[model samples]
Target chain A: MTSVRQRLVPYWLLAPGLIWLIVFFVIPMYYMGELSLKTGSIDTGYQLTWAFSNYTDAISQYSTQFFRAFYYAGVATLLCLLIGYPLAYAIAFKAGRWKNLMLFAVVAPFFTTYLIRTIAWKTILDDSSPVVSFLKTIHLVPQDGRVLATSAAVIAGLTYNFLPFMVLPLFAALERVDIRLLEAGKDLYASATQTFLRITLPITMPGIVAGVLLTFIPASGDYVNATFLGGTNQAMIGNVIQSKYLVVRDYSEAAALSFTLMAIILVALIVYIKFAGTEALMGDEEEAE
Target chain B: MEGSSDLPPTDPESDQPGETAGNTARSGSGGVRLEGVTKKFGDFAAVHDMDLDIADGEFFTMLGPSGCGKTTTLRMIAGFEQPTTGKVLIDGSDVAGLPAYKRPTNTVFQSYALFPHMTLEENVGFGLKRQKVPKAEIKKRVAGELERVGLSREAKRKPNQLSGGQQQRVALARALVNLPKVLLLDEPLGALDLKLRKGLQVQLKEIQRDVGITFVYVTHDQEEALTMSDRIAVMNEGMIEQCADPETVYDRPSTTFVAGFIGVSNLMPAVAKGPGEIEIADGPTVPTADAAQFSSGEKCFAVVRPEKLTVSLPENAPGDQPGIDGIVESSLYLGTSTQMAIKVADDVNMTVLVPNASEDARQHLPGGGAKVRLNWLPEHMHLVAESDPGGSDADQTSTDQVTEGVNS
Candidate 1:
C-alpha cells in the first residue's frame, strides 16, 4: 500500500496541469475535430453527419491563402534572422558593461500591447508620413506608390513584431559561446570573417534553429498584421479563418482551416527538428545523457 | 590513404603552396623580440615597460602567478593584443599593424579551446584548409599531426565526445599542424590533474624539441617552468624579476620575488655586519663569500633554499659560520624527504629539507618541540635586497588588480 501511494505521488503532482490541459485544450480540440467533419447551417442549427467534404472544400478554395501565409511567414522569419543575429551577437560578445541594458532594450517592446505596436507601424508607414516621403525622395519607392496597405508593410510588421522572439533565443545561445574559441580561431590563422562563419555561427546553431521556429510558427497563423496593414489581395489563411468563424459564421469551414494550419505546422516542425539534429533540441543536457 | 594519388608531388618544406610567401619566411625558425612593451587596460598597467628577446627554437616560459601580465605579454606576442607603447618584432620584422591571423603564430589556449562542433580531423585541418592547401596534403598532414599527438584513432570524434586530456591533444595538434613559425601556449596544461600535467609536460618538451619551433609558454606552475623551459622569465607585478636558465634561476635569484616564487626559500632579515659577514635579526652572524655586493650595515635578506640547510648537533670548527639554535616546530614526511620547520628566533622560522638517502639521516630528525641546530655553508647564503614584502605581496596586488578590473 505504501509503495502504491509513493508511485501515485508523481501523478498527483501532475494532476492539476494535466487536468487543465485536458479541459481547456484536449476536449476543445476533440469538439473542434468533430465540428470540422459535421454538416452545419445556421438556419437549422448544426447537424453532425460526418461531412468530411468540408476539409476538401476548405483546402481547394483557400489554397492561395495557405501558400501566401507560409510565403510571408518564411520571408519574415528570414528577415528576423538577418536583422536579429547581429543585434544578439553585439549584445552578447561586444556590449561590455552595457550588456544588461542592451538585453533590456531587446525585450522592451513587450511593455506595450502588441496590437498597439502594430497600429503604430501603420501610422509610421502612412502615405504622408516622413518615412514614406523620405523613401519616395530617395527613389526607393515610386512617387505615386504608397507604403501602407502593401505586402511590404505587412511583412515589415511581422518581422518587427517577431524580432524579439528571434533575438532572445539567439542571445541566450550566443551568450554561452566561449570567447576563447573565437580567439583560438584567430590564433589558428583564420580571418575574422572566417572565424565568425566557421566558429561563431556553427556553435550558435541551436539558437538560430530555436529563433527560426519561434518566429515562423506564429507569423504563419497571424491575422492582425494582415488586417491592419495588408490589402484583401494579401490576406493570409489566418485572415480567412477569422472571417469564416466570426463574420461568415461558417463553423465547419473555420474548424477545418484551423486543423489544416495545425497539421502543416506540425509537419514543418518535425522536418525542421530532423534537420537541426536532436542533440541541439536537448540543449546542454545532451552531454549528461 | 589513397587520397594522395590525385595530387602532384610537393615539397614538405614549402609551408603553403598557394599562399604568398610573406608569412612563410620565418617558418620553422623564428625569434621574438619585445622592445619597451607595456600593456595598459584603461589606466591600470598590466605589463610595464618590458624588453625581452626569445631565441629561435627555444622553449621560453613567462612564469608568474595569475594576473601578473604573463598572459597579457603572451597575447601581445601572438598579435591578439597591441602594445600600448612598444614594438613587438617577430623574425626581425615589427608586426605592429598585423592581426593575429596574418601573423605566422599560433596559440594553444589555456582552456584548450577546441572547436566543439567540429570533429578532431576537421579541427586539425582548419588552418591548412584556410590557407587553401591541397586537399590531399591536408588529409595527409592532419593524419600525421594526429598521430604525433597520439590521437589518430579519434579523428572522426567531435571535441565534446573526447575526454579533457584528449581534447587538449587535439588543441595541440590543431596549432602544430599549421607549422607556424612561433607557437604560443598560454598555460596549456593548467586545467589538467597533477599526473596528467606531469606526463604532458614531458611530452610537450619532447614535441618542442622534435619540431624545432620557437615555443613561448606561459605558466605559473614553477615546477612546469623548471622542468620544460630552456629559460624562464620570472614576472612580478608586470615586471620581470629575473630571466635565466632553470639552474641559474634556482641557484642565483636576483630579486626576493624570484627567490620566493620559484621555490621555497628561507628568507631571514639580516644586516651586513662587515666584509664577508652578515648578522641575522636577533640571531647569529653568518659569513659569506661576497660581502662586496652589499655595504656595511646594509639591510638585506639571507635567502637560502631549504635543501641547502642541514640540521644536526651544534658543533663547529674554528673559523666556521656559526649555526642557529632552534626548536623543531613541525616535521612533514614527504615521500623522498622530510621537511622540518625550526623556530630559530621569536619570529624567524627556518626550514630544512632532510633527504632520506640513508637510515642514519632519517634517524637524526628530532621530534616536535625538541631543540636542534640549523647550519649551512657560507657560500650557499644568497643576499637579495629587501623589497616590498615578498611573493605574497606580489600575489595579493595582482589579485586586487584583477578584482578591480572586474568591479569597474
Candidate 2:
C-alpha cells in the first residue's frame, strides 16, 4: 500500500501540468488542424468543405519562401553546432572550478527579452555605426556592402538567437562524458586528438543532433530576425505566413501554410529521431558515463 | 572446447610479458620501487612519503580503509597521479612527471571505464591499435586477448550487452593486451554483488597466477586482499601501518588500528600488570608478553580476536583458569557457523564465532545476560599503545578521510 501510494504520487503531481498542456496547447493544435480543413464564405459562419485544395494552394504559392527559410535555418543550425560544440567542450572538460561561472555567463544574455535583444542587434550592426566603420578599417567587414540587411544577416540573427539551445545540450552532453573514458582512451593508446575524435565526439553526437533540431525549427519559423535583419530579398517563410494572415487577410491560405510547415517538420523529426535517438548509440555512452 | 574461442581465463602474475611492458621506465628490470612517494592535493596529503619494493611478478595489494591512500599510491604507480615528492620506479627509471599514457603501466579502474562505442574486440585491440600495430598483428593480438579473457566469441558485442563479470574481463583484457610491466587494479570487484565478488576474488587470484604479471591491487576489503595478494600493505592516514603476509598481518598487527581493522578483534583496557600479564576491565588478570613495552601501571590495550577466545561455563572450564564471565546476548545463525554477542564488561560487547549450533534457546538470564567465561591464550592479545584510558575520542573521529583519499 505504501509503495502504491509512492508510485501514485508522481502521477498525481503530473496530472495538473498534463491537463493544462492538453487543454491549452494540444487542443489548439487540434483546432488548428480542423481549421486547416475548412472553407469559409465570410458570411456563412464557416462550413467544413473538407477541400484538399487548401494544402496544394499553400504549397504552389509559397514554395520559394518555404525553401529559402529552410535553407537559412539549416545554415544557422550548422553554424550553432560549429560554435557551441567547441565552447561546450572547453567549458565542460577544461574550465574546471570556473564551470558554474561560465555557465551563468552563457545564461546571462538569455534573461533579456528576445525581441529587445534582437532589436539591440540592429543598432550594433548599423552600417554607419563606428563599430562597423572600425571593422571596415581593419578589412574585416566588407566595405562595399552593408551587413544590416542581407541574407547573411538573417542567418547570423537566427544563429545568435538560438545559440543557447545549442549550447545547453552540448554542455550537458560534454559534461557527462566520463573523464575515465578519456583516460582509458589515452591508456589504450589513443592520442589526445584520436580520443576526442573517436570517443568524445561519438558519445556526444546525440546532443549535437538535438541542438540542431532545437535551433533549426525555431529559426525557420522566426519572422522577428527576418524582419529586423533581412530586407525584402530575405524575408523567411515566417514573414510570408504573417503577411498572409495580417497584411493580406488570407486566413485560409495562412492556416494551410502553417499545416504544411508542421507536416514537413514532423517528417523531418521522424527522420532525425530515426538516426539520432535509440539507434544513435547515445544511451550506451550514458550508461558508462 | 567448442566455445574455446571465448575469453580465456587468466592469472596475470604467472605470465611474464617484459620489463618495459607493464613496468614503467623507472622499473626497467621488472621490480617496482617507490622512493619517498608523496601525493599532496594542495596542503592535504593523500599519500605520505611511501617507500615500497614489490617483487617482480608478485600479487601485491595495498589494503586499507576507504581513505588510507592505497589507491593514491596505486594511481601514482600507474602514472595517473604523479607523486608530489618521491619517484615511482617500475624497473629502474623514474616516472615522476610522465602522464598515464606515457607510462608502461595500465589500470583496471573500479568503474571498468570501457569504451561503449567499441565492441569487445575493438576495446581489447585498442591499446595495440594505438601503437599502430600491423593490421594482421592487431587482429591476431585482439583475438588472443579476447581469448585470454574468455570473451573471444563475444568480441562483436558491446560492453552493455555483457554481464558485469564479462565487462570486467574485457577491462582486464584491455589492460593485459598492453602487456604493461605492472597491472594496477583499483577495487576492480567493487561494483559486483557479494556472491559475484567472492567468485571474482578467486578468479582474480587464479588469473594472476596464470599470467605472472606484477599485480598491484588496491582495496579496502581485507578478505579480497588476503586471498589474492602475496604481500598486503595495510595503510592508514596516508601511511603504511604494516606490510606483510596476510597471516602475519592478521596474527600480529603492529598497531591498535591494524588489529581493529583486519578482523573482529576484541579490544579491552588493560595495564601492564607484569611482563606478560595485565589487569583487564571486569575480568581476571590476563598474561600477554607482547605488550611489555609499557612500564607497569601505564595504560595500554589488549587486542585479541574473537575466534581466539574460548567460551564455556565455569564448571566445564579448565581448573583455576582466569576468564571474563558474560552472557550470550544474541545468537546469529550464519549457515555452517553461529555468532553470539556477549556482554563481558558491563555494557561492553564482544562477538564470538562458534562453529556448533545450540540445541535449545538458553535465554533464561535477564536481558540474555548469563554467567559465561571468556578464555584465550596469552599470545592472542596484542598490546596497543592507548593515548587515553577511555578511548572514547579515538572512536569518535573515524579514519574515513584517509580511506577516501586513497579510493576516491
Candidate 3:
C-alpha cells in the first residue's frame, strides 16, 4: 500500500496544474467551439442549432483579410529571422564579456508596453518625421509618400515587436552547438563560409525553427499593430475578428474567425515543419541516442 | 629526422638508435618540424620554446599531464593555434600564417567531433567534397575508407546512432580519408571505458602502421603512449622532459619528472659512495650501474620500478646482501599481480609488485605490519638527479595507471 502511495505522489503533485488547465483551457475552448457553430445576433442570444454555415460566412467575408494576416506575418517572420539570427549569433559566439549586456538590450524593449512601442514606431515614421524626410531626400520614398498607415508599417511593427521572441530561442540553440564541430570542419579543409554553411548553420537549425514558430504564431493573430499602423486596405483577420466581437457584437462570427485562424496556423505549421525537416526539432533527444 | 625524405617511411633507417638525437634536418615532403615554437596565452606560457621534428610515417606521441602543453603543441602544428613566436614547418615549407583549412594536416578531436547531421559516408567524404572531388569517386573512396575502419555497414547511419567506440572509428575513417600528410589525434580514446580503450589502442596503432601517415597523437595516459608511439616525447611544465623510443624512455628516463610521470618511481635520496655503490637516505648502501655517473658524496635519487623490487621474508633474504627492512602497510591482489605498500621509514614508503605465479605464492606474501626485506638488481636501480620543485607537484593527480605494467 505504501509503494502504491509512493507512485501516486507524482500525480498528486501534478493535480493542481492539470486541474487549472482543464478548468481554464479545455472548458473555455469547448464553449468557444460551440459558440463558433451557433447562429444568432447578440440581442437574440446565440443558439447552437448546428449552424456550421457561420464558418463559411466567416471565411467568405474575411478571406482577403485572412490572406493579408498570414502574408504580413510571413514577411515579418522572415525579417525577424534575417535580423535576429545575426544578432543572436553575435551574442552566442563573439560578444565575449559583453554578451550579457547585448542580450539584455535585445529584451529591453519589453519593459515598455508593446502597444506603446508600436505607437512609438508610428511617431518615428510619421510623414514629417526625419526618417521619412531622409528617405525622400534619398528618393527612396516620393516626397508625397507617407510611412504610417501602410503595409510596410504593419510588417515592420510586427518584426520589431516579435524580434526578441526569435532571438532568445536562436541564442539558446546556437549556444548549444559544440565549438569543436566548427573546428573539425575547418580542419577538414572547409573554408570559412563553407564551414558556416555546412556545420554551423545545420547545427543551429533547431534554433531557427523555434524562432520562426514563436514569431509567426503570435504575429499572425496580432491585432494592435494592424489597427494602429495599417489602413483599412491593410487590415488583417485579427482586425476583423476584434471589430466583429467588440464593435459589431457578432460573437459567433468572431469565434468562427478565431477557430479558422487557429486551424490555418496549425496546418501551416505542419507544412513548414515538414519542409524544414522534423529531425532538427527532435535534436536533443536524437543526439542523446 | 635521420630518415631521408625520398625513402618510404617504413625504411629501417627511421627507427635506428639516436635517430631522435636532434641531429638530422628534414629536407623534403612527409614530415613536420617546429622550430623554437612558443605559445603564450597572455602572461602564461602554455608551450615553451620547443623544437621537434616528426619523421614521415612515424607514430610520435606528445605524452604529458594536463596543462603540460601537449595539446597546444598539436594545435600549433595543425595551424589551429598560431605560435607566439617561431615557425612551424610541414613538408619542409614554413607554414607560418597558414590556416587549418589550408594546412596539409587533419586532427581527430578528443570528443570525436563528428557532424551529427551527416551520415557516416558524408562525414568521411567531407574533405573530398570540400576539394570538389567527383561524386562517383567520393562515394567509392568513402566506402573504401569506411571499410578500412570496419564500419562499411554503418555508412548510412548518423554519428549519434553509433556506439562511442563506433563513433571513434568513424572519426578515424573521416580523418584517414583525407590522406593528410600528418594525422593529429587529441586523446581520442579518453572517453571510452578501459576495456574498450585498450582494444582501440591496438587497432589505432595497427591502422597507423598500415597507412604510413606521420601520426602526432597527444595523450596523458602513459601506458597508451608507450604501447602506441614509436617515439614518445614526455612533457613537463612547458618543455619536453625526454623524447625517445618507449623502451628507452621507460628504462632510462632522463629526468626525475620523466621517471615519476611515466610510471610509479620509488625515488630514494642517496649518495654515490663509489662506482656501483650508493648509500640511501641514512639507510642501507645500495648498488646501481648509474652510480658510476655520480661522484662520491654527490646527491641523487635511486629510482626503481615497483616491479623491480623483490619482497621476501627476512629469513629468506640473502644473508650478506643489504636491503631496506620495511613493514607491509597494505596489500592489494590484482589478478595477474600483487601490489603491496611497504613502509621503509617513518616518512618514506615504497610499493612492490609481485606476479601471482601460483595461489600459494600470493598466499605466502606478507600482509599489513609484517616485516619484509626489499631488494633489486644493480642494473634495475637508476640514479636520477634530485627532483626539481617545478616538476614535482604537476603530475601527482594525473590518471596514469602505473601498475598496468611498465614497458621496460
Comparing candidate 2 with candidate 3, which one achieves the higher TM-score?
3
lDDT of 3 by residue, A122-157 (tens): 888888899889989999888888888999999999
Model 1's CAPRI class is medium
Off by over 4 Å in 1: A1-13, A42-47, A284-289, B1-27, B315-322, B357-364, B388-408
Tell me the lDDT of candidate 3: 0.85
Each model's DockQ score: 0.61, 0.39, 0.68
- Model 1 Cα lDDT, one tens digit per residue, B306-408: 8988887555323365577888998877657887888888866777878899878687668899877887787788888754635556434433432332243
* TM-score for each of the candidates: 0.90, 0.82, 0.92
Off by over 4 Å in 3: A284-287, B1-29, B274-276, B319-322, B387-389, B394-408
Each candidate's fnat, listed in order, reads: 0.76, 0.63, 0.89
Expressed between 0 and 1, the share of native interface contacts present in candidate 3 is: 0.89
User: Docking category for candidate 3?
Assistant: medium
Candidate 3 per-residue lDDT over residues B165-280, each given as its tens digit: 88887898888777888999999999887767877788788777666789999998888999999999988778898899999888888777787887776767788898888999
lDDT of 2 by residue, A1-289 (tens): 9999998999999999999999998998887777777887445555677867888988987898899999999999999999999899999988989999998988888889999988888887889888779989998877886888888788888889999899999999888899999988877667789888989988888788778888989888989998998899898889988998788766666788898998898898888878677645345554641
Q: After superposition, how far is residue B254 of candidate 1 from its true place, in Å?
A: 1.1
Cα lDDT tens digits for candidate 1, A58-160: 8899999999999999999999999999999999988999999999998999999999999999899999899999999999999999988888999999999
DockQ-superior candidate, 1 or 3: 3
